[model samples]
Structure formats: C-alpha cells, structure tokens
Target chain A: MNPILKRLGFRPDDRVVIIHADDLGMCQATIPAVAELFDAGLVSSAATMVPCAWFPAVAAYARATPSADIGVHATLTSEWDAYRWGPLSTRDPASGLLDDEGYFHRTTPAVQERARPDAVAAELHDQINRALAHGIDVTHLDSHMGSAFAPHFLPAYLAAAAHARVPPLVPRLSEERMRAVGMPEEMIAFARNIVPQLEAQGVVMVDHLIGMPLDRHEDRVETAKQLLGSLAPGLTYVIIHPAIDTPELRAIAGDWRARVADYQAFCSAELRAWVQDQGIHVIGWRPIRDVLRGA
Target chain B: MNPILKRLGFRPDDRVVIIHADDLGMCQATIPAVAELFDAGLVSSAATMVPCAWFPAVAAYARATPSADIGVHATLTSEWDAYRWGPLSTRDPASGLLDDEGYFHRTTPAVQERARPDAVAAELHDQINRALAHGIDVTHLDSHMGSAFAPHFLPAYLAAAAHARVPPLVPRLSEERMRAVGMPEEMIAFARNIVPQLEAQGVVMVDHLIGMPLDRHEDRVETAKQLLGSLAPGLTYVIIHPAIDTPELRAIAGDWRARVADYQAFCSAELRAWVQDQGIHVIGWRPIRDVLRGA
Candidate 1:
C-alpha cells in the first residue's frame, strides 16, 4: 500500500479520484473555466502557471479564496509562438533556461537537452516561491509538458517539492505499473528504480494516473464519460485543460477549441452526476499534501 | 546658439523640432498609433516603455525596421490603476521601486521618497541593454513621468545616459529660462548652478524644451498647430502620447480620447503640412546621438 494514501486513511481497494485542471493562468480562456468547475465542485484541483499574463487574476482569486486547492504548475516551456513569457528570476540569466531570444524554449526535450540541473532547480524554486509570495497556499506541485519528468530534472524537481513541503504529482512507479500503461521498457525500468528513492523521502504521489488519452478528443463529452466510467478503484489524477474559447485564447493557442471542449465536458452536470452514479470518491491534493508533509 | 543643436551642425535659428511620441509600448493602443505616425514621417522619434506589455511588438518592429529611432523610456512609474508594470531587473527588490502591490509607483514624488538612486540607474541600464539585446540600435534614453528629473535621481540618470553614450532628455537650465517658465525660486537657483557643471561633463542637453499642455486636450490639432508655430529658434522636444481609442485603452486610461486626439493630430495631413510650412526641420535622436557620442 502507498504510504501517502495510507496516511490519508484510504483503503487499497477504495476508488479515489482527483479531477485536475491544468494551465489555470496560461491565458484569458483558462482561469474562468477552471474557476467555474472549481466552484461547482466538479474539478477538485488545478495547477497554475504563474509566469503567464493572466497570473495576477489567479493571484487575485487565490487571495480572495485562500482555500482553493491550487497547485503551482511549475512551467519551463513557453510553447506558444504568439503568446510567450520569460523566466521570473532575473537573478541568473546564464541559467541555460533561456534561448538566444531570451524566452524559454517551447519543448520538454529542449529543456532536458539544454538546461543545466542547477538552473532548472533555480527556475523551479523561483516559480514555487513566486506563488507562495502571491499568497497561494499551494496544495501540490506538477510540471508543464512533463519537463521535470526527465531523468536529469527529476532530482531537482523532487528536491523542490520537498523544500516547499508540498506533494508532487510524480506517481509511485513499478515495472508492472509502467508496463500497464505501455511505457518504453527502459523508461519503465528507470522510473521503477527511481520511485522508491522518491517514496523514501516522504513524497506524495497518486496511486495511479489517468485521463491523458482523452485529450484533444473528437468527442469530448463521450470521451469524458468513458474516462469517468472507467475510473479504477484507487487514487488517480484525471488531468484536463479547461478553457472557454475567446478571441484572446484563439490568438494565443492553436488548440483553443480543444480547450473549449474540455471546459464544456468538465463543467457538464452529466459528468458530475456520472461520478456519483459510478460511486467514485472525488478528492483534492490538500489531503495528500497534509499526509506527505505532516508525516 | 543652441550648444546641442550646434553640435548637430544646426544654426542658432534653425528652429529644430522632434515630434516625439511618448509611451510607444505602454499598452495595446499606443503602438499602432505611433507606428502610423512613424510610417507617415509625422513623428520623427518615439520612446519605448520596455516594461509595458506591448514592448515585444515594438521590438519586433524595431528589428524589422532597423532605422527606426527607438529610445528606451526609462520607466519608474506604472501610473494607471488598472494597467501596471514592474522593473526589468529583479536583482534588487530592496531597491524600493515597487509599491505595495508589486508594481512601480505611479508618481515621481513616490519614486523620490522610495527608490534608491543606484537601483534607478540599474533599472535604466537594464532597460537599454534589453532593447540592444533585442536588436534595437537604441538611439537615446528618456524618463517616464519625469522620474529622472528629481534632484536625487538626476546624477544616476545622467551617468546611465553617458555610460551608454546616449543623450538624455535633460534640458540645460538657466535662471532666465526657469523664471521665464515661472518655475519655483529654489529649483531655479539649484538648476542655474547645476546646468554648467553638467555642460562641463560634455553631457548633451536640449537648449529648449516644450510639450506639457497639449496632453488630454479637446482640440489637439489646434494645440499642435499653435505649438509648432511658437517653437523657439533652438532644438525643442514636443512630447505626445498617441493611441487609438480601443476598449482596452478605455478601460485602462481615463484619457483615452485625448490619446486618440493625439494620434489624430500627429497622423493628420494638415499637421504635417503645417510643420513643413513653419520651417521646423523635424529630426530624431539619432542625429543627436551622432553629435553627442561622435560614434
């Protein structure tokens, strides 16, 4: 049994789920939709990208609603062309995180290949510290585009979460667990070996992670229903990007409609009803953080 | 004879004018209006607020149009309630430039009371270097909200400009000039003695300066026509804040219509024709830099 979940006092067979929205402060579209889902108690948690243009809005909300189960979505990539942001810390420009254009590179592979581990650590520390300073009682931590999932970044990522006394969304891995998801053999072996080292440091991770396949789906409602119905009996994080389609979002993101669809699906009353009908126990990161850090 | 204008090979009675647009990158509204005036050759030069949201747009334009006379508007004020920005250098938060809300103070008095002179110099240096790194052949430096005009900041302001080999917008002050303008007795006395010390350092200063009343005017065309006609027979800077009256600007600034009026006046064919008729030889800071730096 997972120690973090055991501390939360959930049995091994009990089905617990965290409907988590990603990219809370990326643009004009994301925050409002996430707020709506959060308000309705449909999505119990969200991760905020603090360096984006809409961060002040999230900070405003965080200040107003201090108990919101918001995590720092530690960002390294500026992915979109028209909408780009730079690092928060001007303390270190030689951090290898910035390209020649002085913006962060748009890909995880580039971050892995080009960025120094200490620089990566510095940026991550800056992001988390920025949120905490913004008055966010950050419940957990996660990565944008899996940038921290790279082997080189894993230690820094884990250390940052530990330093902040927050749970990270790095799942407890095993060969069976990785192979169950059809991960590459080498990665499965690597992740399996690394999981225990992280677990030993009192890191909190979901028992199983799900809902990535439902992303950018042709039929979001149907896919969302399928995702909700198929929730296995254990703690799982079902990730989604919820955003209302606005002209600003359209200009900023190419996948604006996908975001709109995700927003619609998550905000759907049917999805809420289906969770209850399926007897799935919905949870947030607050309890997990309490269990991990309090221990 | 005007010493600075004389350095530029202008006669004593040349009546040189720089139709200088202020706040080129302060918001979404300002850029397009400034760009149009620059394109039509109505405005000879424009200062850019590097901390503002629209800076990247102007930087892109400066890159594409290499000959544009872009000067960094050394900003210490974030003025408006809704639209706010902070410093470029994160190295010194203890510098006291940031207000309680983490934005720059909205007034020069606040800056004088709070900001460290060294930090002001660092911020100004960083802004210019950021522009240069963005491929802007930055022509000069100027202060936003006259922040650098405070007696406490004047030395750092001039030092930064001199260090960059770029001229600042400090006019050479004299008692007669100060008394003529109805300035305070104390300031006039201080400025009378200080001007010669600055001139001794080979610091380039404008012989005459105008452009205060035209802001927020109901009839900008009439005001502009009058301003050009009354220009002294020396180098003078006519500052204006031009912007298309967009909803964002309307929401951000109460003086949006005045900005629109400014945009209209500078882009107006009648104004351009009037300047030509008045024999005001319109020039930019590029020539001033040429004379001042001899580079």
Candidate 2:
C-alpha cells in the first residue's frame, strides 16, 4: 500500500480513484463535453491543453467555475494531421521542440530524439504559468501523450510540478508495466529511481493508472466497468478523453467515435450508480493538491 | 468624385480619414495600444488577426466593449520567422494556404503563387465567422500583407465581404500608385476594372490609402503629420500598426520600435491638435458597416 494514500486520509485497503478527463481545450467538441461531465459530477478532474486554439474557452470556464479541478495538460507534441501547435516558451529551431513543419513533433519518440531538456523545462514552466495567468487554480500537472515521461524530459516534468506546487500524474508501475507502455528502458530505470524519492518527499503517487486504449472504438462503458472492477486498493488515476460528437470534432480528430463514447460512458447514470454500489471512493485532484500544499 | 463619401454622409470635399490600426490581435502589445487609442478617441478603427494566439484576448475586449470598431484582418500569410499560425478553415496541405512549414506562407508572393482561391475564400469566411461567434460586432474586412489584393484572390475577397454584408477596404488608386506599391500589373488592371462596379453597389471605398514603410523606423509623428497634411480632399485610410513597448513585442516583431512609435504618434496631444488644425474628420468602420447593412 502507498503511504501517500494514508496521508490523503484513505485506508490501506481502500480503492480510491480519480476520474480524470484529458484534453479539455483541444477543440470546440471537448469543452462542452467536459463541462457537462463536471456539471453532472461525473468527472473529478480535467486538464487543459494550453497550446490548443480553444484554450481561452477553457480559461473562461475555469474563471467562471473557480472550484473546477483543472490543471495544465503539459504538452510537448502536436499529434493531429491538420490541427497542430508549437511551444509557447521558444520558437527557435535550436530548441529542438519543433518538427520540420515548425509545429511540435507529432510523436513522443520524435520529441525524445530532438527536444533539449532545458527547452522542455522552459516550455513546461511556460504552459503552467500561462494557465495560472488565466486564473486557473491549477490542481495538478499531467502529460499529453506521455510526452513528458521520456527519459530525457521526465526530470524537467517533475521539476515543473515541484515548482508549481502541484502533484503530477506519476503512477507507480512495475518495470514490466512501464515497458509494456513502450517506455524505454532508460526511462523505466529513471522512474524506478526517482518515484520513490518523490514519495519520500510527501508527493502523492497513484498506485495504478488505468485508461482505455485511444484507438479502440468498441463499447467504452463495458470497458470502464471491467477496469473499475479490477481496481486494487490504494489511489488510482483513470484517464479518459471525452468529447461531444460534432461534425467539427469528426474533422479534427480521427478517433472522434472513441472520444464521444468516453463521454457517454462516463456520463451514464448506470456507470455512476455502479461505482457507488461497488463501494469505491472517488476523489478529485483538489483534495490531493490541498494535502500536498499542506493546507 | 467617389460617391462613397456622399453615401457615407460626407461631402465630396470632406477631408474624412479613418485613423486605422492594423494587427490588433497579433500579440499582447497590440491590444492595449488599440484599446487606449480607442478610449482616447484618437484612432478610429482597428482589425484583428483571428489566427493569432492572442486573438481571444482581442475577442474578450470586443465582447466587453461592444462599440469598438473591430474588423477581421483577413489573413493569408504568417510572415514571422518564429511566430507563425495556420489557417482555421482547413489544414489540408492541398489547401495551398500553408507553406512547407504548415504555417501560412511567410511572403505575399508565396501565398499568391500557391494558395487556391477556394481555400483563401473559406479561410476568410472562417476568420470572420469566428470573430462574430466571439461576440465581435465585426465592422469591416481588410487584408493582411495585401495578400487578398492578388488578382486571382481579389474576387474571393470581394465575395466574402459581400456575403457578410460588410464593407471591404478597396482603395481607389491610380496605376502609378498601384505599381509603386508593388501591385502586380494584373492586379492593377483587375482593381481598375472592379472598383467602379463595387462603388456602384454603394460599397464605401477610400479615395486614398496611406501607410508608412514598414521597414522605416523614423520619427513616426512627423511622418503621420506629413501624411495627414497631404490627404486629398476625400476619404483617406491612414493605416498604422501600434503596439505597446514591451520585451515580448521586441521578441515577436522586428519592427517593434516603429510599432511603439506609431502608438505614441497617434496618442500624442500634438498630433491630435495637428489633425484638428488641418480640419481632418476622423471616422471609424462602424458607420460604414451600418451603411452597408442598411441599418
């Protein structure tokens, strides 16, 4: 059992989970879907992509809803074919954060191969600072596409979270699990060495990080149930990408169906009732943030 | 006599000029300068670049102050080396709006050579519609870098403005003046043919368009006075790009000094008195927009 769960007032045997939605400001389709989930109390946490075109809408929502548990979805890659964004801190090609086309590289491997660690750090800080300036009471930090989890970049990611005084989504995983997620051996070694030190410094670490495959378009509700049923004791972070079904979304995203399904699955009354019936404890990042801040 | 002055309730001899600022949403430096100029009743009109990162800030200002004479600066080029943006309508490589770097081409000639007329039209409409959706009472349409003035794209520009029922910036210039501004011979001929047709439809056209050389970082106040003094006895559009002096501005714009100078020049009490002493009548785009909308 992770001692940080105990610090968060959870028992060793308790199965606490945070239902977090990623990519809140990716486009028009995302904002309404996440807002609905937050309004219905279906989602406990969400992070905004600060570099995306629709970010100001998310900033407006955060200002309007001061209690919303929103954080910076620290971005290092612009993955879409048509929709793309570059780094906020620096546009110099020497920063190695941009692809040949000047947008952030589309893949994590490309980022790992090219992005300078100092530039990564600067961008992470810039993203978080921009969110703060927009009046977001940033609750935590997380990665988009796990770009920050690259071996060369992870230190900067942790440093940014530390600097922001917020928890980062650093889930505890075995070397095999890390390798299964396509994390390089160097990153696996780095995470193993550093995560424990972070925990020792009273940083809250999740015991598990569960998420549906982004490309899988099958029934998400059933998948959610299966994942929730398999949750072990300690804190778990359940990541989702939920967006409203719209023609604009269809144009912007290749996995539009999966995103729409995630929204429906999470917002469903059946799923809400099932989580309660299963005696699972659902928590948001706010309380954890408070604990970390020693409030 | 250009009949637009009469339709706009100005006499044929009225020295009416719109003291207009371009690139209001290009960066943070622009917003405050334009807002102050508008507040001080110095500058008469301004337009925003919808694709710029700071566009939402401009939208927020427009929403808060509904009477600001803001228009869409129809953008087809992202000229900055580090700071760049792409089209909103579509990001398909085939759209020809984007250069090899996936941003709008860095030069007007590149846009003229590669951009499809259909793509240019779609993007123009998208920029306008986006500003409208954000609560901007869009007052007029103008081109960025004169990209729309290309002979092939001029028709699309006119069509977009006609569809939106807003006046577009069509300045009546002689072949000599057009050639002096580096207008292609084809564009010069095209404008000569189309200006009369547009004027017949009651679209307000400026008798003269005056702007300082973008590369010239001289005493802008003296230049402004000279230009105002030389205004022909008809409606003139005096275009300026004003921005507050900031280190960020210094980074984003090569002509930061000139931009700051423009802001200072327009906001100066001396310049205001000089314009008044010369009997220059300052107006904004709102009245023209109202006339076009038949309000």
Find the 10 residues in a row with the least total lDDT in model 2 chain B: B81-90
Q: What is the TM-score of chain A in candidate 2?
A: 0.97
Candidate 1, residues A214-293, lDDT tens digits: the string is 33647887887787777666678888888876645665577777888888887888878887888888889998887665
lDDT tens digits, residues B1-295, model 2? 7665677677768799898999988866788899999887879999999887667678889998987999999999987643567776665678798776456899999999999999898888878887888788988999998889887898889888888888899888989998997877877888888888877877677888998657876888898888889888888899999988764466457889889889988888889988999889998988878876774
Kindly give the stretch of ten consecutive residues in candidate 1 chain B with the minimal lDDT sum: B208-217
All candidates' chain B TM-scores are 0.93, 0.96
Q: What's the true lDDT of residue A146 in model 2? A: 88
- Residue range B211-251, candidate 1, lDDT tens digits: 73634667788988887888778878888888887645664
Which candidate's DockQ is highest? 1
